[model samples]
Target: MTTKVFTIQPNKRLRAVEEIMKWAHVRHVPVVDERGRLVGIVSHRDLMGAAISTLQVRISEVERLQHNAAVEVRQLMHFPTATIGPDERVQRAAHLMRSLKIGCLPVLEDQHLVGIVTEADLLHIVEELPDASLALRI
Candidate 1:
C-alpha cells in the first residue's frame, strides 16, 4: 500500500488528472470530497476510455486536449469504489481486486482515504517471497 497517495477532486478537469498521473508515474488516483472523504477512483484505463469515446481516430493533438479539458473527473471516475481496510490481510485485497476485475483498491480507515493497494504492489510481495517461483507457477 502507498501511504503517499495522490488524489483529485471531482470537479477537476480530466486534463489535470492526466497531467498528475503522467508526472507522478501512477496509474490510479483516488477521488475525494471537500472533507477528504473517498468518493471515487480513476485509472489510466478510464482516461483512455473517456478519450476514445469522444474523439475520432484521426483527431489532432489540440483537439484531444480540448476534449480532455472539457471533461471533469466526476464524468469518468468509478464511484462507490470497492475498498479495503488497512488491517485486512493482503490476500483479501488481492482477492477483491481479482474478483472485481479492478486494478487497485483504495485503503480506507475509519471511512477516510488512507492509502491504496495496486496489482503492482501485490506483485512486489510475490517477488519478495523466498519461493516466489513456486507461487508464480500454474
Candidate 2:
C-alpha cells in the first residue's frame, strides 16, 4: 500500500487532476473533503472517458485544455467508493478489487484516508514470491 498517497479536492478541475497524475506518475487518486475524509476516487480510465466525451471532434490542444478546465473532479469521480482498512490482509484487498472490478482500493484508518492499494501493488507482491511462476500459472 502507498502511504504517501496523492489526493485531490472535489472542486478542483480535471486539468489539475491530470497534472497531478502526470507529475506523480500515478494512475489513481483519492478525493478528500475539507476535513480530509475520503469522499471519492478518480482513475485514468475516468479521465479517458471524460476526454472522449468532451472531444468528440479532433480538437486543438487549447480547446482540450479549456474543456478539461471546465470539468471538475466531482463530475468524474466515483463517490461512496469501496475502501479497505489498513489492518486488513492483502488478500482481502485483492479480492475486493477483483470482485468490484476496480483498479485500486483506498486504505482507510479510523475513517481517515491513510493509503491506497493498487493492482500494481498486488502484482509486485506476486513478483516477489519465491514461487512466483507457480502463482502465475493458470
Per-candidate local distance difference test = 0.90, 0.90
Best by TM-score: 2
**Tens digits of per-residue lDDT for model 2, 1-138:** 989999999999999999999999999989999999999999999999888454468778888899999999999999745899999999999999999898999998998999999999998998887874655456
State every prediction's TM-score relative to the real structure: 0.91, 0.92
Which pairs in model 1 have colliding backbones?
none
In the range 1-138, model 1's lDDT, one tens digit per residue, is 988999999999999999999999999999999999999999999999898443458777888899899999999998744899999999999999999899999999999999999999998998887874655456
Residue 50 of model 2, lDDT score: 89
Instruction: Give the range where candidate 2 is weakest over 10 consecutive residues by summed lDDT.
Output: 129-138
Q: Whole-model lDDT for model 1 versus the true structure?
A: 0.90
